[model samples]
Target: MPTHNDPDTFTFFPVLIGDIGGTNARFAILLDAYAEPKEFPILATADFATIDEAIQSGVLDKTSLQPRSAILAVAGPIKGDEIHLTNCDWVIQPKGMIRDLGFEHVEVINDFEAQGLAAASLEPEYLEKVGPGETHPSLSRVVVGPGTGLGVSGLVHARHTWFPVPGEGGHIDIGPRTARDYELFPLYEPIEGRISAEQVLCGRGMMNIYHAVSKANGTEPVAANPAEVTALWSQGRDSAAVETIELFATYLGRVAGDLALIFMARGGVFLAGGIAQKILPALRQPHFRAAFEDKAPHSELLGTIPTFVITHPLAALSGLAAYARTPIRFGVATEGRRWKA
Candidate 1:
């Protein structure tokens, strides 16, 4: 646990940490160095006009803590001072957040970066094992998830430190390698004729699978959203919904296996985000594991790597708190200057 550091040790106090996604934004206040983050209710992104509005209305107004600095992990690419979400309409600017929100310092990072940091120190109780394998401390680890969008990141451990590597791996083209995929993927005409993993892995992606399954069956689609599709699968009443989830698990496993191989994540492959947590039962089925280990040339190598589902709800927030305490601990490269009081 990190105690409140001396002024010389850290430059901020009572910092605000946030995880903003396409669907919801979660806020928490770190009042002291060692205290747990006090979280507020999840705010729907569509309900607020801007990021500042969401923070002011949903966080600052509800809490008594006065935060001088804020570190937000947003669901988008972060370049310069502007952040434009790929899935949502909100645009975030760090300079504007400082000027209008009266913050002394503001830092924005890709949401999966935070998740990767958190993956470095997740407690055993917060994780549910997905397959058999061991996690080695000296090796690298990967975290991938599907929510409003797909997110991919990795943590590399070296010289007694963990470093977060963020990338838009989700945008890479997804190649079909199975019988179901051969039949299903053609139905998902690639976005601009090139299909990325996210197009068939995220929330909207699941809907695409559902619709594709329904069309293949020559039946009308029943569910209106991802949740409804999952509900139908959970009830075991709709064959198309069941097939949709089965495909989701299988494709996710393939993607995870590919990423694990790419990063050589011998430490583990952790599944994060809302969808993974909700669909754990489906993922545990044989289709997922079979696809994950189907890499013929490296099946033996992948079999040694563990896979898990991150069960902690506010993992990104916890990672931000860890970074705020000692930025060097997580070894994530962040850009921001401390504001003078």
Candidate 2:
């Protein structure tokens, strides 16, 4: 397989890195392989016709240096050269980007995988602890979050290296595990008689939770969107919205805990994505950690694993830069296409 040359040796002073999501696309310039990345304003995905257009108008047209290599962490599944984003219409093609954008190398990967890659390297200020317990460096770490949809991935540590494994774990079936869970289940109709975790964990999930809670309490649902729900919850103006966010955090903790058990993530569980960052207070609630630690037989072990919310805006971009520098070290390029210089 062809490989991109070391970016540090390239004539271009900065390499391009991007994090594309349903709501916004963020681009940055990695001045050095290991230095802080310089980022541009977040571009609304609705404003652009294609991913290339966003990059061209937002980053390339504004910056002077010509980037030879690029890595984009997109919010979708990357099957091969062609990738379809989960929550938007943007389709990314690696070969087309290279041919049309004059890039020597271009790679696209799942957004959560990028978050997993950046989990270990995230600065202290960018992380906000959710529960207690220190990280076990030798064990795996799990990354899960909800934005346009829920994303799930894991990081494995071996031979002093970290490798990110991204997957569609959010589509797993979700059921009632507690009384609160049972109460919320009857509100929304399921897809094929089943409720995927994404149905109750993402932006739509929050709305579902709010509407369900309202119906259960004999009150008509009034919230318009997840933002409105969160805003109402923050201001303590809407009880139904508050309950929805509380249940959102609790259920998220339950899923995070389940994933931690699956991966034996003693290193930690990192809550990522835009929604996770917005609801830090809810995540810090006792119900959140309680649900996370409620697992039996291994509750002690679960208690030993710490959890955190990723507050860094450029985490995925940083991880892409890291992967660009040493793809083998990260071991994430096995599936995604890599254009060699």
Candidate 3:
């Protein structure tokens, strides 16, 4: 395979794109600049010892096309050559991928950055509006997702280019506000001392809320996992489960609203993750929007800022494909996050 090292004129043709999260890894291949991405089935991260093995068995073995470049969105910060996932055991080393998989170039980014990119360009059909508001094309936007962990990022449009700002916004401090929150907040399991947003916002966080609610009600917790909790909530048979889902929605809305205020994200605030999509009905309720617009002094401003749940399952892949096809359209910073042979 040929290699292109010139940063300004590099081409990412026949690219292998991946959205590697804590529990699952989704892969796809973009044949060229003009072709649509060919997607593959989702793979459990634990099934393979390394990402290269997973790619070889789950992607390369099934496709006839050879991918020269690899673009991966991982569930952690891009620190150095070796990237460790925040919630999984997979350690992604770009150099190892190039040496073992024979790729010419590799780029690793924070998973939420891909969501931010998708938010900047996703069409209306892929978005389900959560409440009433309009999108301001010229303003900034934010993307928050709660899956294996909480992912947060911001998108800004400047000089005709979309820029994604990725950070550990998931770890921001979150506190109780209402009387019910005061009763349940103390019972939640904290990471160290205080409760961060991720402490009660992700899959495990759902269970944390469930357990806390059960403890508050002085009843034994019935749900073992997030899915079971959701099922019980849907059936309305368990009060703890129902309250857990309701609290999760309210907390999500509060955090999203906080981010919207921070970025003044008039373009919109998008919710992307398994939990957000799975609990669409809960998010659509009045409580979610009420919590989102509860900001004092600026509640009216937030009311005009729209919120949406991203309906597309392969949204991160779409973002990577867009960047691979038209690199100039998005100002994705890849100084230390990119490796080339």
Query: Which prediction has the highest lDDT against the true structure?
Result: 3
Q: What's the best-to-worst order under lDDT?
A: 3, 1, 2
Local distance difference test, candidate 1: 0.85
TM-score of each: 0.94, 0.93, 0.97
- Can you tell me which runs of candidate 2 are displaced by over 4 Å? 1-13, 326-328
Best by TM-score: 3
Q: Candidate 3's residue-wise lDDT over 85-115, tens digit each?
A: 9988989988988898888989888899999
Off by over 4 Å in 1: 1-11, 336-341
Q: Name the lDDT value of residue 80 in candidate 3.
A: 88
Q: Which ten residues in a row have the lowest lDDT in candidate 1?
A: 1-10
lDDT per prediction? 0.85, 0.83, 0.91
- Residue 2 in candidate 3 has what lDDT? 20
Estimate, for each residue in 126-209, the C-alpha lDDT of model 1 and write its tens digit.
889988899897799999989998999989987677888889889888888878778878898578997799989999999989
Please state every model's RMSD to the true fold in angstroms: 3.0, 2.5, 2.4
- Candidate 2: C-alpha lDDT: 0.83
* Model 1: residue 97 alpha-carbon error in angstroms: 1.7
Pairs in steric clash, model 1: none
